[model samples]
Target: MSTIDNTFEAQSSAGVSGPATRGSIIARLERLPANAMLVRARILIGLATFFDGFDVIAIAATLPILIGKWHLTPWDVALLIGASSVGQLIGAFLFPWYAERHGRVKAIALSSGVIGVTSIACGFAPSFAVFFALRIVQGIGLGGELPVAATYINEICRAHGRGRFVLLYEIVFPVGLLASNALGAWIVPRFGWEAMYFIGGVPLILFFVLRKLVPESPRWLAERGRMSEAADAVHAFERTAKTALPPMGDPASFESMVARHPKRKMSDLFGKAYWKRSAAVAMLWMTCGVIQYGLSTWLPTIYRTVYHAPLQLALNLAVAASVLGVLGSLLCAMLVDKVGRKPIINWSFMLCALSLALAGVFHDASVYVVAMCCAFALGWLACGFITAYVYTPELYPTSIRAFGCGVGGAWLKLAAIFAPTLVSKTMIGGNLDVAFYLLAVVPFLAALVVQFLGIETKGKVLEQLEA
Candidate 1:
């Protein structure tokens, strides 16, 4: 009899029978050679991630134009920028629970639909109250998509080169950010701020495409004891392999490893085995959130209002910073598996702090100097930001992986909800330096926390990591 047949017999005799045992499912997946299905899955999921990125900065790009057209006050600008984040915060808490109960793909599709429909409504909003309400509703979709998507992508990939594979897919997000800025710079000026929201709504089509093309995470299925579905999902990927597959590992051993760990509950996130990890990731994500949204949402407006730069020049500079962000994310993707997650996160946060401090110190200098420093700060933070997606899911077991990611993302949304207002208040006298200085502190503290508390998850399988 074949090894897989023996695995099934063993599982059946052990009173754990299913169409396929979880051990066989995992062993087959781990041995799957890269193929068209994996690429296709990545691309389809990357599109959802891309739109999340695009919509995130869509407000940043359009804010400068809206500020003038609506004659918005600084508080109004803060509220508008924060509206989606508020919705995202709510989505962050809600969807992960949905994903944990229903499935990742379903949660993602529903959220994408929410974002697409509301984003279209945002374009047609007739008043500030209407737009603000639309943005918050759109934010719910935006908030739900990313963490679930990250969890899905992480579950599908094998441990070997997983970091590079997932991070490469994640690069699309930064590219989306870049695209929104580049397009907004061109489109909003020619068409109107409404065009940005119209364009943002185009991802509605992706909702259907996702349902058709992408399969659910087999790891998630196996964890949920849906072995029949898990087996089918594994075979779908195996069919795409061009080369001979590697020998499957011992399924009995894999099963034993999994059985050794007690089933994790959501409350365990703050329990002994996980609380440190939860704390570290929370701080990491929130700090990244405060810095990322604080800058991306405000840079263009600061350029326009404080520096008196032309609207195009301000948007163009934001575009330049996004380009640097993409480069930094790419660089991290290439190196994450090699150097490992902890060191990369630590160094990136520290360097980001240095850059932000420099920007704050030189805030009194020429606009170009401050811009350059802030751009570099964002570049460094992008490295840590992208790494968080890779690292957060790794820290949790399969049963709670999506939920863990959601909670970490919740911290991000929580920070994002308050960051714009904090930035606005600090820049009261056009003192951009104060915001930068304050932003620098959180990341530095986070780096220290990571150094002491963060778990290293390089080149390790998800199940094994949980063990």
Candidate 2:
């Protein structure tokens, strides 16, 4: 197989299934083009993730109003904001467990349903405590969706432009984030804070659409020995490929195996074979977590607190910065496969550190706010953010794909948990520059780690990473 052809095909090695069902499903998914079935899967999965972007920003967007509405202290506000991150930690792990056992479809439906209902209930929260509790429930769903969706999206795509398609689906996250900021800036003044939660509730409707339109990962089923259902899922794509592509000038053939694949436990992530990849992915997640959650949760608040920008103006700047993030993601999607994964990640983390650090150095500059926006845009917002989302799931195979991704996500939520406290203590106490300077060092260190330890996933078969 060509490098691009290898991108989608599973490895030629035995797995938990030993020789049984080794690579049949992946061999099938690998030959497909940008057909209707792939397009439909992207849209369905992307929609679920798109709302996750909004859900993550729900607290960040409305905290200004919430602070006043409930007479909140900084600690109270921090607790309220971080509550969801905490919930996300649990949900991230929880649903992946469910996904590995039952199916990705069931896991997502359960998670999305949680998000929709809790979001609506959040609109009616009469007190900060009640709202905080509801957000934890909402967080569970929000947390579960992205990694699983990334795995789902990644599973369906061949490595040809895998980064681009997955990131495009993933880009909805920042767009959803940018949308939240834009809408909050527009709606909060007129419609009041409750409107943010109410508007957020709207994406819950997409959950039903997702369940109807999307199917379980065929490879997941095949790995579990459910050959009949797996064949059914794989057939949908086969039909699409037949319609979409001309007959192969040369026919390709695959070998089939007969045997029972062993069930994969979450612990397999730490087994000798997978331990290194898991560690690398976890480190990437931890570094990206600090940058991702820390920045997303605190950027607007930094503007409002240190610069004294009005709530609306601060959020507007956040939306504008996120538009830059959107543009950055578009750029990364174009170049990721061509340039490869490790290089994009290395450059992204380092540049993000430098830019964000510069934004801090001149914190009191007349252009300080724009400086921050620029730093966030070029550094992590676009390429780095896209890199982590697309790359982490690629490092693992179908057996523990969600759990591996979920572990990385848990680190992000961990960062989310501490990011607020770190900011509240410093930015609110008149030492904003110190806080940012500290944050700047993290990604730079992350860049160095990637340069040394990161594997070049480019031009390799997705399953070959483990092989």
Candidate 3:
């Protein structure tokens, strides 16, 4: 079979029962289990994303230390930060295609290894130029991690528990952020900035673990005409997961698999029924990027500038506040399916707006008051988008899901590029109130956009969603 033909037909009999081209995929989803293999997959991806979050935040956390150690100027610091962001931009735009063309499991493994090695190298860099270059490389690795993880989970996770499962992955980000901040606090004081890099490199060790354990995504395999191998993977999943998975049919010829699944191109995302949904996901993710990244990158800076706290004190506060963010994400995972996407998002944002507004009031308030407001805002901000990470894949049909998710989420990395720059420049320029006030607008806008364009997928099947 031609590679293109193989691509569409590559599902393991165990992974999915239908041809990729027709019928609802969700009906097939019911057969998969909430088994150990499924939890392992989610944990593996969550841990990887946790590291991605850790690496990104670790760089920021160590900046104060880097400034003192390296004697960097303001411009140098900006360049250092910008380098990683630029690399993330390139990776987010291009990595999905690589995964689609090469393989999802391979792409995920490579991205993880790259982040690990680059993180280690970042610690030992002899100069700012080299350090910035390594940061860019690490960014590329981190950037690829999320989309690949999302695609992996989307293919393997059963329809019933998929929403909570994916949100669990999202919850890992704040968990990672808290880890990074905790590391920064412990090591930056005792061991200095390089310690963060050393710790960040640990996930590289998981590369071998992943290589041995992480199977090729069965859905991708079935779509690609490698049915037998895919089927083997499914059996392995059932064994390890302890789930009563569906049995695979007789191994199909590659030609027959293609005749079943059919390849979907990126351009399919623009089709009549899908474009609006795509646009909604794009906006929602972008808004998520603006608020989440904006606040995270700037929290320490805010504490330092407004509260006149020491850098150590500010980072400590940011670390504590990050824990609140994690708690909020966990809450989202708990409530999202029950509350429904729109309501959780709407309520999260309304609370976020109020929190941000409260934070704005504390621009000059007492230290305890300021900390309380920031903590509340952080909770709302984290939960608001924990829901998005779960909702995006549900928005598209299986044939085009990866594409829909990749494209819809592109705006997030795009927002990351500009939000940090804008927030840092404006807030540090003594317009801190303006920064918080502007952030207050995002949740409202996110709520409005979701209300207008969002569909409730809470307990509905994915097949019905596609129709």
Candidate 4:
């Protein structure tokens, strides 16, 4: 039918010593039964991402109030947001080593527990320093969850449908934002800003469920030559699938199965052959972090200040826009498998950039159109990174995939650390248009880099993508 369908039918295998065929992956997954296990995996990971999205963006929506309450200068507000990014940067680098050692599912579970505890702590912190401290801890959890989720999905997903699966996983981030924004709008007026964190801490519920339900990545076991354990894991999955009454592929005997190819080192990804890709994806993620956090976080503030929307109205709009943003994540999930990751990202970034430019320059547009366009821009821009979330894992092998996603993500958080101040300064200096224009420029550079250096990862399996 379609390219994606054809690819799914073919089952592309990149790491197992053969050419990637698009049909094989879909066929493999088809053997598994339809049941609660897969659903649980998606929901658990998605819920974590949802909390992350909320944690990442909540500051923006809450900032104006914090400013008023604490007598905050722009610089102080920037520092508050930057602190979390710094934690994310550190966590991104460190989590890979831990995930490599401990396993992806375990890392995620630990991060979830960390986020949950830290989030509740943040809610009760009586001072700015304590609040900021909790954010750093919260960020560690956020940063670790991502690479772990990527590795987990990559390990379990069928090759042909992997892109879509990853995209779906990525959707949780935006969905989390939607939930947070809505909750903040409702809770902030009733219970004060701190209550949002109490609500955000609800993800702790996921932690207990995760420990009981989520399985360790079988592929990780295979790579480590723990074949018996790997086979046991797969057998557990197949048995679970069979009980659910779905067709499944024959479970390969662990003893008969060959181990993964020789371990690919983290350093290899930065060498000549892959350096170009590393740069492109890194820059793409960096640019996305700058633009996304800068805009989405500030939208409610802008509405309150420039448009003179009431605080309640501004918060409502932010919450509404955040909900609408899920469309972008869903769009990426739908199209990334078929059209290819590069084109979607290239075009999505371009559209996002253009919309931001228009929003900034056309100060006199009808309010309804401005609302529609801003929502559209946020949705489009949000998708660019969502695609990257799925695309990044595909660029490196299983041995180093966690590392690759981690490093790329570290740059993104680093970019985000600076963007809040950059946007604030530009807006405060009466050059808001300039900020939008600058944002537009970064994506163009990002698109050019991708055109020249990006890799196509539509149908390939995780291990096959490695050098």
Candidate 5:
């Protein structure tokens, strides 16, 4: 039998704990079902993610006004839209590495605090240059919080129900994006674009609740060999035990997770043990970025340029499309646990590619707009975008979970940085089909990658995945 099969022990807890083996934090957490503590943690994390989602699409939400007032050329449009994403690399690479060494809680707190300050500053920028710099700062905060937060949420969830649990909390991100689009539709046109920034800045105050509300991931603590700290964190995450814990070993003998899964060098993320998983996730991230980001940031611009949509109508259409995006994301959150990650991701990406391709072939403006709406729904709800977020962190052990997630996120941001640039160049005049056709190929490929390479993580323990 494989180490994975031997270590995981058939996923049955026997519905009771002997208190001795219960001493292991992983055994303790896995035994319990979801309860109040997890609920509160999700709410707290969801609130931060909601704003992160809001700020992520905030530029796109207000793109019409930026293009008009600033006289932004297509190239300038790409820079303005992609600037925050440029800074995401730093947040994605740096903070999660820090979290691996320091802790998940502190990393999240500091990152959230940075987002708050930068968002408020963005509201008052004097020029496009100042605004661009402010966005980079905000992206830093945005990038830092997500991967670490994902690690904490995933670790605390019960293995049987982990996908639904984590993805449900993740659903807030799209809702935030939808809300930003709706808010910008109403506020940016009448009240001006700064209103969007001001609203985003105000949410920074919620970051305070994170430290007091959510506990560190016990799995992470255990991986670090801080067993006592892991125990305390498990207690903090679960106020009461739901069932019997695993059996402890004889007093003189100890089973060692550290020995079984030896410490991987930082460089090993690209080596034999993890490279396939990493490549699969990275490719998924990039394709989702191209498919989703390419369309998301440019939808309103596409609406105006192609159909000659008026400002209010353009924003209104963008808001309506986001409604589909939100519903699709919620659908993904609901089905991920039931349907399993690989099948859902495979089919979703296939549908996303089909939608984009259909839209590309039909040159009619009405067909194009409706096609985009279909693509948004299929991609956000089922395609590998939401699937990737829930699946990527599960692939690595806690030692590099955050780093793995961070790199996955960084690739998406890097794609976001380029997607808009690519779309901007082609979206002018009647070349819009070029952008759609370009974006379609990757999602189709992503579906195949998931089929062959994506691991089924729906009900598996985090540690068992690497085993």
Candidate 6:
């Protein structure tokens, strides 16, 4: 047996007798077939994720209007674009900590409520200052929702096809982005920018749905020594299984595994075993964040200002790019298992870099040319960006998975904050190309980080990979 399997065996042997040992819980969960319950869980969680995507880019769709309405300067625009990310950074740390302690379902529900309430408040904001403040508060919820959601999604799946399952669900996020852009084109011009915020706030209702429908992650429950609850959670899936479950191994043998490994401190993410993984994933999130936010969040405004596209046309162009982004995420969801996480991420980042470089080089070309180039770049980055969500949780053990994802999420929020400001500063001298050129460097550097530092987790069980 390999070291991980051997250690698992040893731990199992040492475990106390229990009806649902950690080993049995994992085995049962892995053995359970995909069923209606699983589908329901994905849908419930995905609804929240979809709205997270919607709210993220809704500001982009509204920005052109906000800029004109407020007579905002570039700095004000940057702050407005970046305000949510600042709050998200705080949430990235806070909610994951909450998830680790309070349980994933509660954390997700609470954050969703925060997002829903604050987003509605944003719709009623009378001035730029109020809207910005509301966004920051809403961001606290937005930031908390994703990483914890990602962690929750990652924890529940079997390792074999986990990438496909998780990424397929994650595709809803880009779809949400696409929906916001597409709807923004129709709604903002017709109903007003306030309508978008009101629509985005609709996720508030999802809070109740999630609390009522989804059970806690059994893996997390097992790790926390809540074996009976974990067993109950597992049995919920077991009841849904169309095929008979494989025999769960000796219960006592697996029960002690959690005790054997013990829960890790948050600092352990930067400690010897995990620091490199932490660094690489953090870099990946930042690279993806910078490209995604710097480009997607600003694309409409860029179209309106730099390229002189009509308002409707600007939003429409952004919707086109978002369509490409959703397609790219779907492609990643399909290919990640076969292609392996590291290769897809590494190659996609390089391709994104190439496209961005070209966009920068020919930035002075026709608007169609620049928009198409940026669209392609966003599409390619979407591939890597979606994959990062699948890969980040695999890097750490269950003990700190949510926490690790939170730290990585923090880096993403930092990038979100930095990218807009950087783009705004670069746009001051009509140096739009300079922003693209700078963004191009980030993914290229990230590609190297992945090539050198990232581990392949494709088809590997999370515990074994961490071991």
Give the candidate number with the greatest TM-score: 1
lDDT of 3 at 195: 84
Model 2 clash number: 2
The alpha-carbon RMSD values of the candidates against the true structure, listed in the order shown, are 3.6, 6.0, 4.8, 7.1, 5.8, 5.3
- Which parts of model 5 are misplaced by more than 4 Å? 1-23, 240-259, 367-382
Worst 10 residues of 6 by lDDT: 9-18
Q: Candidates' TM-scores? A: 0.95, 0.89, 0.87, 0.88, 0.90, 0.94
TM-score of 2: 0.89
Q: What root-mean-square deviation over C-alphas does model 2 reach?
A: 6.0
TM-score of model 1 relative to the true fold? 0.95
Q: At residue 151, give the lDDT of candidate 5.
A: 78
Using TM-score as the measure, what is the rank order of every candidate, best first?
1, 6, 5, 2, 4, 3
Q: Which stretches of candidate 2 lie over 4 Å from their true place?
A: 1-22, 242-264, 367-379
The residue ranges of model 6 lying beyond 4 angstroms of the native Cα positions read 1-18, 249-262
Better of 3 and 4 by TM-score: 4
TM-score of candidate 6 against the unseen true structure: 0.94
Query: Can you rank all candidates by lDDT, best first?
Result: 1, 6, 5, 4, 2, 3
Candidate 4 local lDDT, 323-382, one digit each (tens): 667988797889888999999988987888788778767655655555666777788887
Candidate 3 weakest ten by summed lDDT = 20-29
State model 6's lDDT: 0.87
Q: Which pairs of residues have clashing backbones in candidate 5?
A: 16-244, 17-244, 17-245, 20-248, 21-246, 21-247, 21-248, 328-381
Tens-digit per-residue lDDT, 1-467, candidate 1: 77567546644442334557777777777787888899998888888889999999999888987888889999999999889889999888788889998889888888889888998998998989999999899998999899999999998888899999989999998999999999999999899999988988877987788877877888888888877667667776777787877777888888887888999999999899999999999999999889988777899988888888899999999998999999999999999999999998999999999999998899888778888988898888999999999999999998899889999999999999899988898778667888889999988999999889988999988889883
Winner on lDDT (3 vs 4): 4
